[model samples]
Target: MKLNIQQETAQDFNAVFELNKLAFGQENEPKLVELLRKSSAFIPELSLVAWFQNQIVGHILFTKIKIVNNENDTESLALAPMAVLPEFQQKGIGGQLVNSGIEEAKELGYKSIIVLGHEHYYPKFGFEPAEKWNIKSPYDVPANVFMALELTPNGLENTSGLVVYPKEFDTV
Candidate 1:
């Protein structure tokens, strides 16, 4: 099936929420997505939707996140809360959304992306442990679960820190 990836617009708000609920099945993901939308850090173009027959079937969001280093300096962008409708699971829709998002990140010149997701699933997109880059997440998760990808080589070379999502995330 051909998948169409487009920048999410206001009209897609309700559909994106419904899709997230169905895809993650009533997790904090849906709530976080809503919060991210209102957060100042949201990049409109980075919030994407996958549509088919005029229905949104997938959604991906990349919000600005910070990583605080030992020197107390912070780095940004911790990719999270990506979802594909339940019926669309295991199909390539999720992959397409991820790839599209990554491409968007590249075009915007964002150096790296961090994700706490399935160990097996993300590596196919070139994500490896953020720790390898001296990057860490605020939450405690398995090493393999907290992954990072450099859109360009050495993207994280000077980035050694604790990844912090926006303040809105703290409230969720």
Candidate 2:
């Protein structure tokens, strides 16, 4: 299917919300998206949607997160709650959203991205165990499920710490 990936607009809000719920078969992801939108962490350019036949079929969000260390804190992006309509699964819509989001993030000068997701899936996008950089997720999750991707060369080099997600994430 031909899909157009672009930054989501205000008019796409309702559609994106529904898409998230339908894709995940739950309300958590949709609620997360809404909360992130209102937080200081939201990255407008990285909040993207996949459209097909004028309807939104997929969505992806990248939010600002802090990697706190003893010496200093580094700002990085976090990919969370990406979703695509049920009928759209396995059709590359999700991949497109991910790829587009990553490209846009790099253009915006983001150095790294962290994702808590399927162990088998995210690796295709160059995501590796964040533990390799001594980066840890705030929540206790298996190491492989929490991964990071460096957008710039050695972006995570010497960066060791815990990822601090926005407060809004606490509810979900």
Candidate 3:
């Protein structure tokens, strides 16, 4: 399928919200997206959507996050919640969103991206266990699912600490 993946605009807000709600079968993720859009960590360029013909079929977001240790606090991007229309799932729309988002984050100079997602799916895009870099998640999750991807060589090198997510994520 030919997809038009682009940065989300103000007019796409409600469509994006409904996309997440329907994709995830809940309200928390959609709510989180709204809250993140208003938070300091929000990056307009990283909130992307996939348009199939004219309607939104997929959505992805990457927001600023921090890795804090006693010594240093490093900035990174977090891929919190990615979703595609339920009918559109497993047809590569979600993968297209991921690949597009990665390129966008790299172009914008983000070093690495953190994600808490499926252990198997993300690895195809080069994501690995965050434990590979000593990074820890704020919640209790299996090491394999909480993954990180270095957009550049050694992007997470020497970056280790607890990921500090925006307070908006607590709503999830």
**Which candidate leads the pack in TM-score?**
3
Q: 56, model 3: CA deviation in Å?
A: 0.5
Q: Which ten residues in a row have the lowest lDDT in candidate 2?
A: 91-100
**Per-model root-mean-square deviation over C-alphas:** 1.5, 0.8, 0.6
1-172 per-residue lDDT for model 1 (tens digits): 6889999999998888888888877857788888888988899989999987777889999988777766765455667678888887888998999999999999998888899889999999999988897787788788889999988878777888778778877765
- What lDDT is obtained when candidate 3 is compared to the true structure? 0.95
Q: Which regions of candidate 2 fall more than 4 Å away from where they truly are?
A: none
Per-model TM against the reference: 0.94, 0.98, 0.98
Write one digit per residue (lDDT tens) for candidate 2, span 109-165: 999999999999989999999999999899989999999999999999889999999
What's the candidate order when arranged by decreasing lDDT?
A: 3, 2, 1
The C-alpha stretches of model 1 lying farther than 4 A from their native spots are: 70-74
Clash count for each candidate, listed in order shown: 3, 0, 0
Question: How well does candidate 3 match the true structure in TM-score terms?
Answer: 0.98
Q: CA shift at 16, candidate 2, in angstroms? A: 0.6
- Model 2, 57: alpha-carbon shift in Å? 0.2
Q: lDDT of each model, Cα atoms only?
A: 0.85, 0.93, 0.95
Candidate 2 TM-score over all chains jointly: 0.98
On lDDT, who's better, 1 or 3?
3
